[model samples]
Target: MLSHHIQINDHPFHYLGWGDRNDPVILMLHGFPEYSGAWAEVAEDLSRDHHCVAPDQRGYGQSWAPEDVNAYRTGKLVGDMVALIEHLGSRPVMVFGHDWGAAVAYALAISRPDLVSHLIIANGVHPAPFQRALAAGGAQTAASQYIHWLRREGSEEQLAEDDFAKLSSLFGASMDMGWMTPERRAAYLEEWRRPGRMRGMVNWYRASPLRLGQPGEVITDLPEMPTHTLRVRMPHLLIWGERDTALLPEATEGLEDYCDNLTRVTIPNADHWILHQESHRVAAEVRTWLKRL
Candidate 1:
């Protein structure tokens, strides 16, 4: 495996890579509060057959973290992935994303399907389904209260205070932390402490127009999303951790409505951090699923 930095859209982007460059590419995208290293275990398992590349998307880790919230908007976020794929000299590479990264992957697949061969997402929501659940205002709404909290002014300061005590708590929230040992925790902290990185990560939430609605209230003011431009035609796979409290299974409820070739798998034992908590299972599922492609 190798770690390298490249310029994408005039911004420095850092990524971790594995496997021979000549092999088919499998690009991995990490979620919030985590960097490219989040896919270490899965990348190691898949590198034998496929080249795996996981980037610290624009505003995370050692990548360029723009101070403006507008810089983290969906179009800009998807553009970063598009530029990186072009930079890698590959067309329509297999793409995988988790959490916030998954949202970017979805956007990329929708907006620029020519750049994605297959879309694989774990524990991430399709915007439409997520919006429905977020607007419905029940379990998902309560679980997503953190989104509102993160959007507050000075929330980044709180996350960074007390040596990132509040941020550290996010790892073990309603889930097991056995995978996050002292060393792993230290590494995550190192990434989070990068200058301006924490704030940049929070900007993703701030830039999003999705908001948590009151119980029994549905959002009707969502911006128009033209159907022709917002659907996924490439084969798509969704690996879900059934126990993810933050994003319930309901988030995947209507995913197929937007995907032409869709497959969904639920890992009963896993939670939000399934990539780390159940790397073997996740890797095996990915391998088996990709074989059909």
Candidate 2:
């Protein structure tokens, strides 16, 4: 894997790149606390046919972390993607994201459709369903309780002071017990220990409620953009883990209402961390979908 850094609005963004520059670009965004390395195995296969660019979104890995909570908002996060894509001189690239990264990808597609041609979302529900689920007060709320904890002041100190072992263990336990190798866990611990990085990661949840409270934003409406106004102009593939404990399956029940051209696949026996637990299957499906497109 090749590593590099780019500047977007004065903030340094760290990413991994593979394949030829002339090939079609597929930008991958990883979720909270995960760096671009999470896509290493998948990118290796995809790079054979496409340009794969996986960025460690702001506040994670080697990326810059701003102190302001607003920096972690979806709007700014999507703007960073726009800048990154433009920096690469690629427009309408295929974009794939998991977890919080998926939410950012959805916002990017909706807020700036011209920058994304296709979207592959794994283990995350649409923003509208997510909002409704949060309000309804059930499993979604229960699953998200950790977010509130993270948003509290001094939480990062507590987690970091513990050497990030607890946080690493939480991810491993919640996803796949054996998903994180010692080396990978050590890398995560090192990154989280960076100055202000842990706090920046937590700011994602802190700024989330602001986005959710936006007025005149219809979470249920099909994305409001020229390409998606009438129909989903870009092909969309949704891969979900049937055994996901973080995001309820019911959140995806009415997804078809938002996408005109949607293909849904469920991975049985997989949990929230589908990419880690079933990388080959996920990669194969992504490759097949890209070929069809």
Candidate 3:
């Protein structure tokens, strides 16, 4: 494995890498409250056949984190990745994103299809459908109430209080966290301890364009997103952890309509942290799916 620190879009960026230059590259994007090391296990396995690069995106880990919520906007977040991929030979590579990472991945694929040959998402939702689900005020709306609280002012302070008791609970909420061992938790603590990191992390939620309503409050006025901007034109893979409570399956109910070539898989007994809980199965699924290409 290798550690990288370079200037991307005028800010210092950090990423972890596995395998050598000769291997095909698989760019990994991790979600909220997690860092590039979140891909350590799966990347280690995939390194046997591919070079895996997982970056500590804009606000997390050692990456440049602007406290400005605008920095977390979809275009800025996607632009940061565009710069990274350009730095990595400017070739279309397999892009895998989880949770918040999926937001950027989807935007990259949509705005610059030439940069992504394949799109993979684990326990994440597309903005259009996710917005619709939230507007409907259904199960997903109820499941996503945390977003509202996260968008509130000083929520980061609350998360940082009591030794991050609130943030820790958020991590373990409605999900199985047994996969989080002591060392792993300690690493998370260390990263979260970084100055302004917590605020930057929650900025992702605050900067979100998707609107939410109180439980059962149907919102019909959320503006529609341009269809051309949300379509996934490349071969796509959708992996779901069936037990994920934060994003119910209904959130992705119509994902097929947005992709021409799509494949889906579900890992039982796994939750939002599927990457950690079922890294083996996720890697195997990725390997088997790629074989079909």
Candidate 4:
């Protein structure tokens, strides 16, 4: 793996690259509380056939992080990826995203279909169905009340206290976190402890316009999704760790209607952190899914 700190859109951007430059590229996007190293294992395996570019997104790791909530807007997040693609050949590369990274990837594909060749998401949600589930105020909204906490003022401070015990607990979140070994936790703390990184990371939740319905109450005031433009024309792969508690299967219930070609796979033992819990298995699934092309 090679570490690079390129200036993408004038801000210092960091990414980890694996494999030969001439190989097919896969842009790997990590979600909250994870840095580019989150994909190190999977990328190491896939590097034999494909080059993997895993960026630390905007608010995580060594990447530039502005504390203002507006700076973390969805448009700017998508634009950062667009700029990264432009700087790195801008070809229609395959995109693999997890958690919040999936949000940026989906928006990038929807806004500029010419830039993304294939879309891959692991235990993430598409906005339309995600919003629907949140608005329905069912299991997902109850599960997602954490968003409100993250959005609260000074919550980031609370999360950073006690050597990040709160953040660590949040990361575990009742899921099988056996993958977050001591070494990995130390690495993640190194990233999180960076000045302003915690607030920048939490700003993602604060800046999001998506609304959460009161648990047990169906919401009629939810915003409308642009069904006309959200069509994902590329081949799409949805890899699910069936045990994800934060985002239940209902979050992806109607995802098929938005994609031209969609393939879904489930891993029985893995949860939201499937990329970490089953890295090799996930990599194998990715290779098999790509063979469709």
TM-score of each: 0.97, 0.90, 0.98, 0.98
What TM-score does structure 3 among the candidates reach?
A: 0.98
lDDT of each: 0.89, 0.79, 0.92, 0.91
Question: Model 4 over residues 1-293: C-alpha lDDT tens digits?
Answer: 99999997889999999999889889999998888999999999999999899999998999999989999999999999999888788498989999999998899889988999999999988999999998887999899989988999999899999999999999989799988788988999999999999999999999998988668878887766766778889999999999999889999989988889989999999999999899999999999988867
**lDDT preference between candidates 2 and 4, better one:** 4
Q: Which ten residues in a row have the lowest lDDT in candidate 2?
A: 210-219
Question: Could you tell me how far off, in angstroms, the CA of residue 115 lies in candidate 2 after the best superposition?
Answer: 1.1
RMSD of each: 1.2, 4.2, 1.0, 0.9
Mind giving the per-residue lDDT tens digits that candidate 1 earns over 106-213?
Answer: 999988988999999999988988887888777888788888789988999999999999988875799877899899988998999999998899999999977687
List runs of model 4 lying over 4 Å from the truth.
none
**How displaced is residue 193 in candidate 1, in Å?**
0.8
lDDT (Cα, tens digit) per residue for candidate 3, span 1-293? 99999999789999999997678889999998899999999999999999899999999999998989988989999999999998988488999999999988888999899989999999998998889999998899999999989999999999999889999999999788888899998999999999999999999999988989999999988886766667998999999999999999999988887887889999988999999999999999999999998
Is 1 or 4 the stronger prediction by TM-score?
4
The residue-by-residue lDDT of candidate 2 on 151-236, one tens digit each, is 78887777776677667655655666577788877777777878888888888888885222222333343333243442344688
State candidate 2's TM-score.
0.90
Q: List where candidate 1 sits over 4 angstroms from the true fold.
A: 224-227
TM-score of 1: 0.97
